[model samples]
Target: MGLFSRRRDPESPAEPFQFTVDKVFVVPVRGVVCTGTVTSGTVRVGQAAKITLEDQSRSVTVSRIEAQGKKRSSAAAGEQAGLFLGGLTMADIPTIPGNDGSIKDGDALSGASVVSVF
Candidate 1:
């Protein structure tokens, strides 16, 4: 037997992997809908929401806008799971009128459609 060899530790810590969402949130729904507060009245149809590793961005349509109820669920960062966003091209991030220079996560948390996964 080689005495120079030593036993290796069988236990190893799991990876410190943290997932960051892209600048768009998409969900597979039967129909198209939009919901959110007009934090920026300057928003229009065909816009993109920029999400980064620091925060989340969501894509949305202007015309699909609707009022959200409290019964609906909210959107949060890294919350899109068990869904497939296929073949859906996200529009450009629309400009909000009174933007405070902060990225919007598309209030899925407030039942907003800002977090569209395409």
Candidate 2:
């Protein structure tokens, strides 16, 4: 077995670790906005993209992420788009249940967290 490998003798099962990102998302000012299934968030700053496939749809990587949880904006979609937020993720809000690729225009994401993997 490897150093960090799991062992099984027909005894018990192993549990999984749950990693997530709880924040907001915004499009880059210059580039065209494309909405995808987020594809995957495993990609870091310099990485290509862990996941970026949409359901025959599109998604865009915004110029910057507007931190509303930081901006203190509990308002709807249109309202939360303008001002810049500061300590948005300060509060431990509930994260989105699953990864769905269907965020449409004017979608309400103020309290929605931006979960990522790797």
TM-score of each: 0.24, 0.19
> How many backbone collisions does model 2 have?
20
Model 2 TM-score on a 0 to 1 scale: 0.19
Clashes of each: 17, 20
In terms of lDDT, which candidate is strongest?
Answer: 1
Best by TM-score: 1
Give the per-residue lDDT digits (tens) of candidate 2, residues 19-54.
122223443443222121222222112111111222
Error of 2 at 4 (Å): 38
What is the C-alpha local distance difference test score of candidate 1?
A: 0.31
